[model samples]
Target chain A: AQSVTQLDSQVPVFEEAPVELRCNYSSSVSVYLFWYVQYPNQGLQLLLKYLSGSTLVKGINGFEAEFNKSQTSFHLRKPSVHISDTAEYFCAVSDRNSGYALNFGKGTSLLVTP
Target chain B: DTAVSQTPKYLVTQMGNDKSIKCEQNLGHDTMYWYKQDSKKFLKIMFSYNNKELIINETVPNRFSPKSPDKAHLNLHINSLELGDSAVYFCASVDRTNNSPLHFGNGTRLTVT
Candidate 1:
């Protein structure tokens, strides 16, 4: 079984401040990692994904994440945050051996204040 | 154009009632799924269908049933809905490939009163 852990439930940061949302996962086999953002009353939008290749992955809205294999972590980061970036972020993982069922973390609510 | 769309974005009904949420995907994807997000914002997979065939069915109660008449449409029907059945149900679709990201609908917020 594969599971994802989002370390923080809520993160408040001032606008233009750098922020990081931590995520960790455990799986018996190789897994695909993804980050999705959900605005208020909206559905999830893909932010980034780590299938293979480079450990560092860039995504929309100037967000990025690094996949750490040894530590089993994939943390999302942004040099500067905007008030519009406030949303609920979810980290999900899918076992490569299995089908398309994605195991998702509880979620991290990012509240950016202006 | 909307990639994935679900009807009745907000649903409020009495307990023990029966209701259905309809979902359609225009992305021509062969695989679709139903996910439920509870009040705490935890998203869990309930059912998945690929090429109109049931592929993944989680430990969901028999009260919840998913039907796919075709690859482009997947609908969910709940029987004898209880108070605990209230949650935001999201419909999503993805390509046949495993690496493709899911395209999600706005979601149907079901409130059991």
Candidate 2:
């Protein structure tokens, strides 16, 4: 079975400050990684994904993530965040072979303050 | 237009009662999925259908059943609802061939009394 671990339960940062949300996964075989964001009372939206491609993947809203194979990590980062960026973020992993169902992390709540 | 839509955005019902949540997708995707988001905001996959056929069925209780009328619609029917079932249910669609991203609906929040 595959599992995802989001180290930070919640991260608080001031507006315009850079932010990083850590994520790690455990899988026996090749895996696909994804990041999703859910705003207040809204559904989850895909932020970015990493399949069999470049290690650095860029997403909408100026967010990006790098897939580290050796560390088994796919951490989401943003050069700077705005108050509108406040939302709950989730990291998920799916097996490359099967890739049937995604295994999600507990989630990291990003709180951006003015 | 909403890419994915679920009816009864908020459902408040009594325990042991029966209820159903309908989901439809307009993206012409062949794969649809149901996911549950608990109070803590952790999303878990409940079921998935591909071309109206069951594909991924999680360890959900027997009381929960998913019916797909066609490739564009997937409905979830819950019997004898429990307090533990009070959560946000999200419907998503994806195109497996393109390895496309999953598009999610605004989720139906079900509250049990």
Candidate 3:
């Protein structure tokens, strides 16, 4: 089984400030990791993913995440957050051999204040 | 154009009533999935279909059923609604591979009173 853990439930940061959201995972087998962002009343949009090869992955909206195999972590970071970046983010994992189900974390709400 | 779309963005129904949610994806992905998000923001996979074949069916109640007319559309039908069913349902699609990210539709909020 693959499970994702997002520690913070809510994160409030001022506009233009840097922010980082931590995510960890536990899997009995190799897994693929992903980060998705959901705006208010909107569906989720993929922010980025870490499949293989690169440890640091860049995504849309200037956000990025680094995959740490030793730590079993994939933490998302943005140098400067915009007010429009305020949204709820989810960390998800899928076992490479487990068919089609994706295990998602209880989302982390990010509030970008001006 | 919307890659994924779902009908009835907001649904308000009484308990014991039956309701259905429709989903379609224009992205032409062969695999589609249904996920539920509760009030606490926990997302759980309910069903998945690939090439109009059921691939993954979670431990969901028998009251919830999923039907795929084709590779591009998947609909969810609920037999008898309960207050616990008041949550957001999201439909997503992928290319039926391991590396691709899933595209999601704007969810349908079902409120069973």
**Candidate 3: tens digits of C-alpha lDDT, residues B27-95:** 878899999999988899999999999989999999999999999999999988999999999999988
Q: What is the lDDT of candidate 1?
A: 0.95
Give candidate 2 misplaced runs (Cα > 4 Å): A96-99
Q: What are the candidates' individual DockQ scores?
A: 0.82, 0.72, 0.84
Per-candidate chain B TM: 0.98, 0.99, 0.97
lDDT of 1 by residue, B31-84 (tens): 999999999999999999999999999999999999999999999999999999
Worst 10 residues of 3 chain B by lDDT: B94-103
Q: Is candidate 1 or candidate 3 better by TM-score?
A: 1
Please report the candidate that would top lDDT against the real structure. Answer: 1
Could you give candidate 1's per-residue lDDT for residues A51-113 as a string of tens digits? 899999999999999999999999999999999999999999987555767889999999999
Interface C-alpha RMSD per candidate, 1 decimal = 0.9, 1.3, 1.1
Please rank every candidate by TM-score, starting with the best.
1, 2, 3
Best candidate (score: DockQ): 3
- In candidate 3, stretches whose alpha carbon ends up further than 4 angstroms from where it belongs are none
Q: lDDT per model, in order? A: 0.95, 0.93, 0.92
- Classify candidate 1 by CAPRI docking class: high
Clashes by residue pair, model 3: none
Worst 10 residues of 3 chain A by lDDT: A94-103
lDDT string, candidate 2, B7-110, tens digits: 98999999999999999999999999999999999899999898998988889999999999999999999999999999999999988877777889999999
